[model samples]
Target: MTKRIVVLGVSGSGKSLIGKSIADTLGYPFFDGDDFHSQANVDKMRQGTPLNDDDRKGWLATLNAILTDNPSAVIACSGLKPEYRAMLRNGLDDVTMIYLKGSIDTIWQRHQKRDGHYFNGREMLESQFATLVEPTEDEALVIDISQNADAVLKEALTLLANSPTH
Candidate 1:
């Protein structure tokens, strides 16, 4: 009963933190989608440029391959669009998406505390929200992230445990 999970959210929405926790708890590998970005894409984000769909295509493909290769793993990715999520889950049957829902102000506070991260600026966060097509209940198990990290992790784990698919 291995689980394949993708923690989805905008930058600063605790994707990496929660995804890693889930992976560690489940004894599965954890991958940060940010690590898969090309140097060019990283530079663009660093320079405060919003990446269009073209910039994300190759990166999404790589992440998709990772999911395809690893049957049981947790991935942290800003899957903002329905198409992007579809691409990420292209060939995976048991994939579960956990969307970390948060407001811009909440995420902004979190982003301000970040250090040396490539994805920066308020405008970038705005762009992500604009691009985001929130998943419906059927598309994902949405988790509100205003709570403490421990609580969020507990909720996520509980949800996964109770999920009919699991």
Candidate 2:
């Protein structure tokens, strides 16, 4: 059976990297949720302004549409809130959520090393952490991000392979 996966995490939690790895391993398409953001949202984030739920409504809807359209794919998204996750999972089934759990300091250090990204600064990272409503054990396969990327990917693949859908 085809599997639809959403790799969830705050910025710099390696969502894109892991999601892409999973997609490639499974021969599925990979989509970065950031790529779907509107120009205005991008500008807001670029300016170090955090986006409220109201600002994310349309963007989330578009992401929902993308998930709805693709039967078997992986997406890297910050499914920070329960409501947002629900919105993304609307009209979909058997969507495996993988949360890349990490501390602010850990992610912040990684964030600092990256370049040319709109989502920058410690404040923005803190805001995301403040806004994050972590998924319950049943809601997502939680993976620690302190380990190296290869270990995380291996663990995620193992978990996904054992998930009901797989």
Candidate 3:
């Protein structure tokens, strides 16, 4: 079965960087979920406003379509809520979810240093955490992001390899 790896986490948790590395290692396509968002959503985020669930429906559908089309792909997305994750899972199988977990201070520091990110500053990160429903073991392969990217990627691959879903 084709593997659909969703590298999920809060903003600044290195989802994009880690997802790209995993894609490179697995020889699959890589997608940044931020690209799937509508301009309005981007605008709202740029203004430091958190996206409400209503604002994300279309974006989720678009990502769902992209995943449906790709047999094997690694996508960096903030699957913060279970409902949001479920929305992403519609019509898909062979999905291996990786939750990149991290402390607020660590990620907030990372968020501060990042440049040209639409998730500007650390304003919405708190909101993101507040909105998040951390995925359990049954829902995703969880890995802490306190380690280096290489280590995180290695662990994610190992967990995916061992996961029943994969």
Candidate 4:
């Protein structure tokens, strides 16, 4: 069966990096959710303004469409809220989520060191943390981003390989 994985976290948690590695290891196409956003959305975020639900509404629909149409892809999305995740999984099954968690300090440092990104590292951090609703008690494998990328990928791969759905 085709499997879909959502790599979720606040900005700078290495969701994009780790998600790419995971998808590559699993031989699945990888998508960075940021690339899916429209220019307007990007512009808004670039201005250090948080997007309201209305701004996200159509974007979520597009993500849903991608997930539905491409059954074999792994998507790296912030998916900051449960509602957003629900939207992504609207009609899908055999989907797994991996939360790449890191402390505020760690993420802050990473974001500060990051170059060429549109977002203001400081402002977006709070908004992302505020909107974040961690995975449910019964759902998802949470991986701490305290270690190197290699170790994190190994752990995530082990779970994917051993999972019943996989």
Candidate 5:
């Protein structure tokens, strides 16, 4: 059976990298949530402005539609708040929520070196951390971001394989 996977985390937590890797391994398509954000939203993040719930409603809806369209996909998104996660979960079957859990310092340090991204360094990261509602034990398959990208991907795939879905 095809599974819908959401690779979620704060910025710099390797959502895009890990999600894409997992997608390739699973022979699924990858969708980066950043690419679907509205220009206004992008501008706000570019300016280090944190987006409120109202600002994300449309964006989440659009991403939810993508999940609906593709049964098996690896989607990299910052599913920060509970409401946002719920919205993403709406009308989905076989959905796997993968939360890339990481320490603020670890992510912040990594964010500093990243270039050509709209998300500003520490400021944007602080906003994301402040708004994050960490996924609970039942809500997601959590993985530590302290691990290397290859290890993280392997761990994720192992978890998926061992799951009842198989």
Candidate 6:
């Protein structure tokens, strides 16, 4: 059976990298949530403005639609808040969320060396940290980000393999 998984984390937590790997390994298409953002929203992030909930509502709705439409897929998103994760989960009966848990310092270091991204690392780092509401025990699979990318991906896949869907 195909499974829908959401790779969630704060920015710089390797959601995109790990999500893609997991999707590839499982032969599921990967969708980066950033791609669903409107140009205006992208611009706002580029300017280091933390998006208010209102700014994210439409985008979350759009993501939920995509998940609903393609039930056999993996998605990478910064599901920073509990409500946002619930929004992403809307109407998706078969969904597994993998939260890439990381420290602010680790994320900050990763962001500092990151290049070719529109977001300014220093400006957005604090806001990302501030806005993050870590996953609850009942909510998702939590993977520590202190591990290497490959290790993280492997761990996630192992968890998924043992998951009820598999």
What tens-digit string does per-residue lDDT give for candidate 5 at 1-166? 3478998999999999999998998899999999999999999988989889998999999989999999788889999988899899888767788899999999988888888999975877898999999998688889998988889989998887876431
Model 1 Cα lDDT, one tens digit per residue, 1-166: 3388999999999999999999999999999999999999999999999999999999999999998999798999999999999999987778999999999999999999999999969999999999999988798889999999999999999999888542
Q: Which regions of candidate 2 are displaced past 4 Å?
A: none
lDDT of 4: 0.83
lDDT of each: 0.93, 0.92, 0.89, 0.83, 0.88, 0.87
Q: Per-residue alpha-carbon lDDT of model 4 for 125-149, expressed as tens digits?
A: 9888888888853567788889998
TM-score-better candidate, 3 vs 6: 3
Show model 4 residue runs off by greater than 4 Å.
164-166
> Whole-model lDDT, candidate 5?
0.88
Error of 1 at 58 (Å): 0.7
RMSD of each: 1.2, 1.3, 1.2, 1.6, 1.5, 1.6
Q: Tell me the deviation in Å of residue 81 in model 3.
A: 0.4
Q: Quickly count the clashes in candidate 2.
A: 0
The residue pairs that clash in candidate 2, if any, are none
Cα error, candidate 5, residue 154 (Å): 0.8
For candidate 3, write residues 1-166 as lDDT tens digits: 2389889999999999999998998899999999989999999999999999999999888888878999999989998999999988898877788999999999998888888988966669999999999999889888999999889989988887767763
Better of 1 and 3 by lDDT: 1
Per-residue accuracy of model 6 over 52-125 as CA lDDT, tens digit each = 89989999999888889885889999999999999999876688899999988888889988888877766687
What is the overall TM-score of model 4 with all chains considered together?
Answer: 0.93
Off by over 4 Å in 3: none
Clashing pairs for model 6 are: none
- Number of clashes in every candidate structure? 0, 0, 0, 0, 0, 0
TM-score of each: 0.97, 0.97, 0.96, 0.93, 0.96, 0.95
Lowest lDDT 10-residue stretch of candidate 1:
157-166
